[model samples]
Each structure stands twice: as C-alpha cells, then as structure tokens.
Target: MEIIEKAPAKINLGLDALYKRQDGYHELEMIMASVDLADRLTFELLPKNEIVIETDSSFLPVDRRNHVYQAAELLKDTFQLTQGVKIYIEKRIPVAAGLAGGSSDCAAALRGLNRLWNLGLSLAELAELGSKIGSDVPYCIHGGTAFVTGRGEKIDFLPSMPQCWVVLVKPKMSVSTSSIFGSLSFNSIQHPDIRGLKQAIEADDYLLMTEKIGNALESVTIKRHPVVQQIKDRMMKYGADAALMSGSGPTVFALCEKKTRAQRIYNGLKGFCDEVYIVRTLK
Candidate 1:
C-alpha cells in the first residue's frame, strides 16, 4: 500500500523574540500561515527493517540527516516496529528557505507512517512527537493559521487569514538560522507588536494585517545577506501592499490583494530570484 501526504510551506506574518531562557532556547511569539506551495511525500511499506528515503532534489541527503528519514526511524524505534518504509519526496519548496519546508516534510512523514504502520496516533500525539524533531514541526502538523509561542511548541489556533495572494521569492543562496540567531543582539533591536497582530487577525483587518507583518530576525539575516532587504524594497516598488522577510531571511514574501499586482511582483522578482512562487494563503 502507498500513502501520499502534502507538506505545505509556511510564511510568518509576524515573528518576535521575547527573551532568552535558561534552557538556552529563545522565546518566540509568531503568527504563521500555510501557503499553496508544498512538498509531496509518497510512502511505501517495505519488507526489510530499514528506512529508505528518495527525493527529487540532489542537494538533499538521503541518509539519517534527512528529516523524512529521521521521522520514519523515530516512529519505528518508539513503537518497536520491525516494519520498514521507503519515502519518496517530490521537492517543490526550496531548501533552507525559512519556510518550514523540512519541518513540514517531517510532519508529513509522521502522519503518513502512523497510518502506514497502523499506529492510530491522534494529531495532538503526532504534534507532540513532532516537537522533538524540530520547533516548526508541530505547526506543520495542523497546517493553517496559528499563533505559536514557547519556542514553537505552544500553539493557539486562529481563524483563517483574510484572503490574499503571496509572492514568495527565494534567492539563489540559503541563510543559516543558527548563525542568524546565534549572533543576535536582541537588546539592540526593536520587536514587532505581537498583540497588535493578534488584534488584526481577530478583527479580520486586511489592511492592518499587512501593515503589521514584521519579523525581528529579519534584520539579523538582512545584515548577513543584503539581498534580503533589496528584495523587500523591490517588492514594494513592484506594487505589493506590504512585504516582509519571512522567518529569518533570503525568502521574502509580498502580500497583495489583487492578482494582477501580485503577478507583477512575482514577475519582477523572477528577474532577481531563481525561485519565485505566487501562492494563495490557505484560508
């Protein structure tokens, strides 16, 4: 039997760092929504008791480092199951793009393996297991709009974001999240208004929502890759209502209510970025 799962990419509308905890993890409050861009995973049961992974992207490793492989191994070990599975991933989202592509793939793997192995785990259970894999994996399990807090483990469900088009532009290069967060000077930077963003989402205020789109980590990544700031500026010039660097950097997203305007921005970014996608926010 074969099982297929969709692992959608997520963009942060608002992300702020609260403080560094003794646990060594920085506290974060973020608003994120899934986009139409996604990675496809196909899982097939195997008779051999070993995990196997295959993907379209040569850049991705098929070994234990791959989250899809890790997810299968995790389930197998936790349940003491002897069954093995082969996972094939069709990569659509760019790697290390700060769009939760890998985390979503891990979440999809967990969900697929649960069914493939006849392990009837609830979504909550799967999300709990996901948190062990990565901070963003839990959010990917229940793809939609959500307010994530507490190092990305605590999730508060939110209403669907107001209808809008998203133009995601990924530069040829990728930014390391650890490098950005490691050297972050939180005291020197300004934080986004998390409360205001929450209010805008509650009221379904599209204009306010667009205005409030911000990411604290963007500055750190912008410093490393000046191209990020250039992308944001170019998106505005191309007719985006508001633009922000999603999550860390490199991948900048522009929000536009008009399809024509979004198309214009997408076309404009295509000249600058190798990977540009015009995707609708899942509402």
Candidate 2:
C-alpha cells in the first residue's frame, strides 16, 4: 500500500523569545499558521526492514540525519514493528529556509506510516513521538494556525486566521537557526505582543493582525544579512499590509490583503530573490 500526504509550510506571524532556558533551548511564544506552499511525501510498503528516501534536493541528507528517516525510525521502534517502508520526498518547499520543510516532511511520514502499517496511534501520540525528533515536528503533525510555546513543542490550537495572500521570497543564502538564537540577547529584547496577535486572529481582524505582526529575532537576522531587511522594505514599498521575516529566516513573507497586490510583489521580488511564491493562508 502507498499513502501520500501534503505537508504544508509554516510562517510565524508573531514570535517572541522570553529567555534562554537552562536546558539550552530558548523559551518562546509564537503564533504560527500554515501556508499553501508544501512538500509532498509518499510512502510505499516494503517487505524488508529498511527506510529509503528519494528527493530532488541535493542539500538534504538521506541518511539517519534526515528528519523524515528519523520519524520512521522513531515510529518503528515505538510500535515494535518488524516491517519497513520506502519514503519518497517531493521537495517543493525550500531547504534550510526556516520554512519547516524537513519538519513537515517528518510529520507527514509519521502520519502516512501510521496508516500504511495499521499502527493505531492517535494524533496526540504521534505529536508526542514527534517532539523527540525536533521542536517544530509536533506542530507540523497538526498543521494549522496555532499558539506555540516552550521551544515550540507545546501547541494550543487557535481559530483559523483571516484569509490573505502570502508572498514568500527566499534569498540565495541559507540561515542557521542555532546561530540566530545564539546571537540573541534575551535581556534587551523587545518582545512582540503575542496575546494581541492571538486576539486579532480570533476576531479575524486583518488590520489588527497586521499591527501586531512582529518577530523578536528579526533584528539579529537582519544584522547578519542586510538582504533580509531589503526584502522587508521592498514588501512594504510594494504595498504589503504587513511584512516580516519568518522564523530564523532569510525567507521573508508579506501578507497582502489583495491577491493582485500579492502577485505584483511576487513579480517585483523575483529579480532579487532566487525563489518566490505567492500562496494563500492555509485554511
């Protein structure tokens, strides 16, 4: 049997790091939502006990280090299953772009394999299992709008965000999430109003949502890569309702109230960015 799953990408509407925890992971509050942009995962049942990955992305490692493979291994060990599976990743989302591409793929594999092997694991169980793989994996397992805290493993589902077009632009450079967090000075940071953003989302007020959009790591990332700042400026100049870098990003996203405006910005940034996408906020 073969199961296919579409794993959507995520964008942080508001992200605030409270402090670096004693465990070395930073304590944070983030309001994140899924976008139409996604990676595709296909699972094929195999007679032998093995995990195989096929992908077009040259950058992604296919070995045990790959998050998708990790997911399979975790599930296999937890369920004590003797069967193996072949995993194929159709990479549409950009790699190492802070878009949670790898995490999403991992989540999708977990979901797909649950059905493929007749392992009756609940979503909560799957999420709990996913947490061991990565901070972002749990949320990716339940893709939608969410209020995430505690290094991103804890999840509180929120109402669907107001509909809007998202114009995403990824620069040629890749960013290291650890490096960005390392440079952060938690003492002097101006935290974003995550509460207000949640309220705006619950009310479905676009303007209020725009006003509350902010990312605490933006300053640190922009300093390292000026192009990130330039992209934000261009998005605002092109009339984006709000613009912010998503996660530890070189990938910047702008929320546009109008589809036409989003298309305009998408075309405008293609010259400067290596990859540009115009997609709707995932429902």
Candidate 3:
C-alpha cells in the first residue's frame, strides 16, 4: 500500500529565550505557524524488513541522518513491525535554513506510517513519538498557529493567523542552528513580548502582530550573516508591512497585505538573493 503526506514549512512569529535549564537545554517560548510551502513524502510498502529513503535532491541525505529515515526506524522499533517501506521525498523547502523541513518530514513519516502499518496511534501519541526525533516534529504533526514552549515540546494551538502574503528570501548559504544557539550569550538577551503577540493573534490584529513580531536569535544570526539583516532592511525599504528573520539565520521573510507589495518585494529581492518565494499564509 502507498500513502502520501504534506510536510509544511514553519516560521516563528515570535521567539523568546526564557532561560537555560540545568540540563543545558534553553527554555524557550515560540509562536509558530505553518506556511503554504511544503515537502511531499510518498510511502510505499516494501517486501523486506528495512526502511529505504529516496529523494531527487542531491542536497539531501537518504540515510538515518535524514529525519524521515529516523522517524521510520523509530516506529519500527517501538511497534515491532516486520514490514518495511520506501519513502520518496519531494523536496520543496530549503535545507538547513531554519525552516524545520526535516522535522516536518519526520512528522509526516510518523503520521503516514501509522495508517500504512495500521498502528492506530492518536495524533497526540504520534506527536509524543515524533518529539523524540526532533523538537519541531511535534508541532509539525498538527500544523497551524500555536504557542510553543519548553524547548518547543509544549504546544498550545491558536486561531489561524490573519491573511497576508509572505515573501520569503534565502541567500545561497546554509546556517548551523547549533552554532547559532551556542554563540548566544544567554545572560544578556532581549525577550519578545509573548503576551502581546498572543493577544494580537487572538484578536486577529494584523498591525499589532507585525509590530510585536520578534526573534531573540535574530541578533546572533544578523551578526554572523549581515546579508540576513540586509534582506530584512530591503524588504522594509520596499514597503513590506513587516519583515523578520524566520528562525535561526539565512532565511528572511516579509509580510504584506497586498499581492502588489509582495510582488514588489519579491522582485526587489531577486538580484539581492538567489532563492525568493512569494506565497500566502496557509489560512
């Protein structure tokens, strides 16, 4: 049997670093929402007891390092399933760009394999299983606007965000999320107004949402890649309603209420950056 799933990309609308825990993991509160851009995962049952991963993009790994492979292996080991499957990923999202592309794929795998193998796992159970693979996998299991806390393992779903066109631009460089977090001086960092952002989402106040959008990790990334800040600056200069770096580094997106403004920002970014996409929020 074969099944297909869509692994959508996510962006942090508001991310704050609360404090470093005794276990060395940083306590975080993040506002995240899935975007229209996504990767497609196609699963087909295999005869032997082995997991196989295939992707056309030479940029991706097809082994256990790939989250899709890890997610499949995890399910097999936990459920003691004898069957195997071949997973083909149609890569649309950018890799290592803080888009949680791999984590979303892992979520897709857990969800798809559940139906394929007839595991009968609930969404919460699957999400708990997925959290072991990556922090973002749990959120991707149910893509929408949410308040995520405690290393991104805790999620509180929010109403769908106001409609807006997002122009995403990624430079031709990959970022290390670990290094970005590593370089952070936790003792001294600005925290985003989480309550304000939440209220804005609840009220469907677009202007307030834009005004309150912030990422604590943005400074560290902008320092490493000045082009990231430059992209934001250009977007704001080109009349984007609001612009900010998505997650860690590299990928920056601008929010606009009108398609003309989104297109203008996209066109302006073409020469400045290699990869640019103009897509609307997924409602």
lDDT of 2 at 140: 95
Tens-place lDDT digits, model 1, residues 125-146? 9999999889999999998999
Q: Each model's TM-score, in the order given?
A: 0.99, 0.98, 0.98
- Score residue 90 of candidate 1 by CA lDDT: 99
Local error of candidate 2 at residue 3 (angstroms): 0.5
What TM-score should be assigned to candidate 1? 0.99
Candidate 2 residue spans exceeding 4 A from truth:
none
Q: Quantify all predictions' global Cα lDDT against the true fold.
A: 0.92, 0.92, 0.90
Candidate 1 runs further than 4 Å off:
none
Error of 2 at 124 (Å): 0.8
Per-residue error at 250 for model 1, in Å?
A: 1.5
Q: Please count the clashing residue pairs in each candidate, in the order shown.
A: 0, 0, 0
Candidate 2 — which pairs collide?
A: none
